[model samples]
Target: MTRDHSKTFYFGSRFFPLPQRQAVWAVYAACRVGDDIVDEPGGGPVVLSDWWARVQSALTGRVAFSQAGPHPVDLALGWAAGQFPIPVSAFQELYLGLRMDLEGQVYRDMDDLELYCRRVAGVVGFMIAPICGYSGGDRTLEYALRLGQAMQLTNILRDVGEDLARGRLYLPESLLNEYGVTPAMLEAAEVTPEYCALMRHLTALARTWYAEGRAGIPQLQGSGRLAVTAAARAYEGILDALERNGYDNFRRRASVSGTRKLLMLPQAWWEMKLG
Candidate 1:
């Protein structure tokens, strides 16, 4: 399958200042590529396993199989790490989370859910926090972790139907049982009121977490703050879209259009610039 780089316009979006844009793109591209290896049609566990191995090699500056030629994601990640004081362990965390996707792991409870979120989203926050100059106490970092968890939870909630179709379930099992929702019900694309109520509750929880995430933005440094803010807002916007659609994600995939996104870019810029 052909890898499409066309959707990467955000990498060059004017919302990001020049200095950090390229480095951010490198990290985003790396993550997107790794994710696509699992997401592509006909891509299987063997393919994902191979990609992870490549990612590990690239992270250590030994890119033997990356299509990025001499400039592998790991090398780019290393450069980004140098430019920012991002923790190396964050990359490990992301890798661990991505592995879950390969195995179609399910969450037994909130604790399991938290671990998955840490792997996928928390590490992203860890990588980004230092770049935004948010270095302080463990409390500040704790906020970042919660911020990441909020985003990941939103994603899991929004993609519930899709993930189920893919033979994966991210909702906590306890919550499912509490609502009388079964994996089979989810797999069958049944949208009962209970399911809707559960999704509404989860989405509300995510919104609150994202609101908490917003508190850390002001603590960030200059342009980096704007970049992170835009990302956070843009992702939250997806949740809003889901709400507007009446949470019928099973029938329609929720998305913010390019025009809306374009408007958001300027609005976000003004918010950060004037403030």
Candidate 2:
């Protein structure tokens, strides 16, 4: 699932030992299932509740996943939960974020959007941190949370044009007003100077989170540290690609080629060693 849906994670998890790698895949697949529920056509509270029930059944072992219940994603999650101290609260928060998307909530400001990012993505860090066995505890988890937010922000920036086409906007209204960019401009796919400035502002914020997240890398155990470093490097490469594309996200999608990802591995490995 990771390889199919998320090339960056698939590339980075190559460094993990078998157990951690599989656990990571399990978590990702489960998250994907939730996202699919919100993203797929005709999904709503009814089906969303059903999905949540299955997840709860899996995580708490309230029902036998194999005997008459649970999706494959939940089954995988059940196994991962048994093996590690997976944070149930993280999943709970994630479901709320899915609910937000289902309700078509709009972003009012950075705080609102950051809260969405934390619930939807940052909690993913909380879920994975225990599997990797961090040394600094909450401190490491905090950084992990920041990394997830940074990645989500990158997703927002990269998908601006696509989201606009879908009649959805992730950019905060406050920021748009401050930058003097109108909804008409965005709808017209105009990369005006103000829009470019707005993109630059958010890009810098994501980069700041990336830097902070990287500082916590050495706190992770075993190959997970290198794995995370590689993931961070590969993911941040997208930002560089966006800059190179002149932030013309409305017309040009920013992506790091597979070769570029491979090239990043050596430097990532070196950084892991240096740490």
Candidate 3:
């Protein structure tokens, strides 16, 4: 699933030992299922709500589907939760984030946007921290949150045009107003100086978070540190690709090439070893 949906992440996961790699795959698959439902045209509030309920049932061992004996993704995730210290609260918060998407909620400011990012992405970091061998540290969790936000911000920037087509804008309204970039401008796929400036500002913010997140990399144990560092570098590479293209996200999608991803591995290994 990771290979199909996220090659960068799939590449990074290879650094982990078998158990951790499988656990990450399980978690990723479970998250992907929810994401797919929300992204589907026919998926509505009822569908999202039902999906959340089924996830809740699966997490609690209630078994939502008897004949099928539980969803395969959920079964793997349930095992992962038992083996690791997966927090149910994080999953609940993720569901709430999905709810926000279903309601077509718009962010009024950075605070609102950050809240959405935290619920949708930060919680995943928290959930994965224990699996990565980091436990019971507020500092580690804070780093996880920062990294998740950084990655999500990158996603928001990269998908700006795509999201606008869906009648959704992850960028904050206040920022748009401040930059004198209107919704119509974005809707029309305008790439004016003001829009470019706005994107630069957002990209800088993401870079800051990425740096802060990297500062906590040494805190992770075993091969998880290498996996995370690789993932971070690969994701950050997208930001670099965007900048290199003059932030023309509408005309083309920003992506890190496979060769570039391969280049990151050795550096990631060195960083892990040095730390």
TM-scores of the candidates in the order shown: 0.83, 0.95, 0.96
RMSD per model, one decimal: 3.6, 1.6, 1.4
**Alpha-carbon local distance difference test for all models:** 0.71, 0.88, 0.86
Report the Cα lDDT for candidate 3.
0.86
lDDT tens digits, residue span 202-239, model 2:
99999998898888889999989988898889989999
Q: In model 2, where do residues sit more than 4 Å from their true spots?
A: 62-69
In lDDT terms, how accurate is model 2? 0.88
As for model 2, its CA RMSD to the true structure in angstroms is 1.6
Ranking by lDDT: 2, 3, 1
lDDT of each residue in 56-103, candidate 1, tens digit only? 665555655445465456577666666776565776777678788877
